[model samples]
Target chain A: MTTTQLSPTPRTTVTRGRSRAVLDRDALLAVLAEGLVAHLGLATPGGHPLVLPSAYAVDPSGPDAGGTLYVHGSVAAGWVRGAADATVCVTVTLLDGLVAGRSAFHHSMNYRSAVVIGTARVVDEAAEKERALGLIVDHMIPGRSATLRAHTRKELAATAVIAVPLEEASLKIRGGGPVDEPDDVEAGVWGGHVPLRLVAGDPVPDADAVTSGGPVPPDVVARARAL
Target chain B: MTTTQLSPTPRTTVTRGRSRAVLDRDALLAVLAEGLVAHLGLATPGGHPLVLPSAYAVDPSGPDAGGTLYVHGSVAAGWVRGAADATVCVTVTLLDGLVAGRSAFHHSMNYRSAVVIGTARVVDEAAEKERALGLIVDHMIPGRSATLRAHTRKELAATAVIAVPLEEASLKIRGGGPVDEPDDVEAGVWGGHVPLRLVAGDPVPDADAVTSGGPVPPDVVARARAL
Candidate 1:
């Protein structure tokens, strides 16, 4: 597979501290794929901006592959409506650990984050929209989408799905242990990294399940263990 | 303790999808207190917006208490410098699970999110800046500030600390199992919640620790267990 090069623009450039910026498209895609939620930033019509949590997935094998990030919500969501026409920023971050440095000034977190900037186009076609919705479901738990009840036509109409091309994006990350100053290291403080990971606990079967006595599906069990 | 009410402004009102907006000030504060990172949204001088993650803490006691959220970074960071007078949106989100509903459309995640909107004021005073830095350190690991090496004057001057007031804030949360439609419930599909939790593993002692063989500090040990 040939890879496309993404030239850094003024907006995608990391102008701040350190050399943590990751410019490779594949590297950025990896960060987006692992993250479960994205914080979407949109400006109100009055021009005040707001950042809200949202669920999203990257299309791996489709016309939109390597180009589009899919996000969906209720049809009436103000951001969902406003995003179709306005340029927005979607950020996905995964925190890996708490870096307990030797001093108060140097404490940091081990994390991987990506920010994508673009205007979203609404997926209005029924077939395409349905596939995007399925991608989202399986994105959270692979293979479970096939087993879940299909989306009704009314349910598809009630949902708003938008695709934002991944043309302008950048990734930043920090890892490993505390980078303490020489003096602080000599001061004999208990300093190291406390690793943190997102793990899955045992699934709690819904009490109101109309269908009872069936064993928990193997796909769901595998997803839990994978997490 | 008297709870101050936050009046709903045009920006604070949840004009979007479901009514997941949280109104209680103390409730919003609790979300802020439990969060480890915040994604700050800012517009570039060229009019494009961006969201970047940063470590933050709410000041529990001080002249800035009850109104300020503290964030700090290198003095040379572009976003940190540009954010002083700009109206910014700081969002903190905690993910709790993968809600696998019986159908694709109803899939969701259990999460608690808080969005704070306001202009950030640079903390220019040396003493206030120092205190804010300590607050951020302790915020990640409770009681960490008292044991860490003191911030040297040079480190204080090298950092830029900004305080964004928590006046215009709102909380949104979703919990429990998938809310599947009645028809899907009757279809006998697997439906439940796979809980996702952030857990900490044993601390990896720094290889360069000047003092060796010391037991891990109780505060650090407790933090790992609490996660």
Candidate 2:
């Protein structure tokens, strides 16, 4: 699949010893799209924090400030319903591993994370809602949407899609080995990032899959093979 | 290595959730200990949410409240310094993948997550602070401290160790497969949980290591060999 189109948004953080405190809009959007899941935090019924896991897709084509990002859920759910009033925050992260520095102060890790925060608008229109549904389905199984049964009108009525323009989003990244104090360079201990990764394996097709005889779709195959 | 220890002081919100969520102190601590990383979230300047990545080690035995979870930072860092005043949340999640069902709504993912919300306190004491630092080192690498340079007093002071008591913590989990609508049972889509896993592979030792003419630690070696 093509990488999501991203807009150019400048970063505002200053550097502290090579800290990658800034990443432009496209990099942030791509990181969000590469993700299959996101941890969405919102307010609970009693004013407590409520976090839910959800699927999301990047709509790199919506808002004027920065392309909007989309996340959908049930309309009555507190998170989706409260989107307009409360800030909608969704975070996607990829963990690499432990960075053992020679000095205790220099320890760190390698990770990629994007935090998108903005006001959300419910997609009241029918066409965009259906399209959003398709995008979600495709997100899980790229070409599977074309092969699945169509969503019933009742099902459509129960879902809610919200668009958050990624105007205020920012990305921070850290990688490489531990940045140790100058004197501890020769501490004689193994100190560096132990690379962590999420690797996809060969697909295990379902017993009742319709076209099991054919090779996996290039997209699916490519994704798996990339691992 | 032993897992991070959980505090016995149970709070109301921490006790919420199903049986799976009601883990004993050790159980909660084990999940955090075995897991290599955490997704740390804090409120942004605008009152929106911002989550970044950080490596953390639980202090199983130093403090009265199950020893604070030791997270490091630059002394002048604003977040670590400000965490004590605001609600700081730490989330550790292990995703197990898409649990697909005939009905789209029945889809789910099996995951283990520990959500901890608490006021953080900066560890400023000289002796106790060193213990937190050791736990963090051992947490990352079982026998690491004795393997490297010890922390100097100045380094310890400059490095902030912020601990959040696990009292207000809670855990949520969703596991198992698709519970499809009866009508969708016969729908011809390959449906069931696509099991996901993080497999450890062979460990390639650092090119420059003073191994006493020995192989990797048996447990670490076995972990890698399993994959």
Candidate RMSDs in Å, in order, are 3.4, 5.5
Which one wins on lDDT? 1
Docking quality level of the chain pair in candidate 1: medium
lDDT of 1 by residue, A39-140 (tens): 988876766678988888888564553578888988877777777867888899889889888888778899888888887788998887888888888888
lDDT of 1 by residue, B1-227 (tens): 11122565767666663356555888888878888889998877766678889999887564544578988888887888778888998999989898888888778889988888888899998888888898898889989899876788898988999898877777778888887777667767778889998999998778765255266777778888989
The candidates' interface RMSDs, in order, read 1.7, 4.3
Model 1 chain A is weakest, by summed lDDT over 10 consecutive residues, at A1-10
Candidate number with greatest DockQ:
1
Candidate 2, residues A1-227: lDDT per residue as tens digits?
Answer: 01121232222132233346554666886677777777776644444344555777776776436776677777665566666657666777776555666665666656776767666778878887777777776666565556556778888888888877777665667665666654555444554446667666565544544343244345445445544
Clashes of each: 0, 1
Error of 1 at A106 (Å): 1.2
DockQ versus reference, model 1: 0.66
Clashes of 1: 0
Once fitted onto the true fold, the runs of candidate 2 whose alpha carbons sit more than 4 angstroms away are A1-18, A21-23, A43-52, A201-227, B1-26, B61-67, B200-227
Q: Which pairs of residues have clashing backbones in candidate 1?
A: none
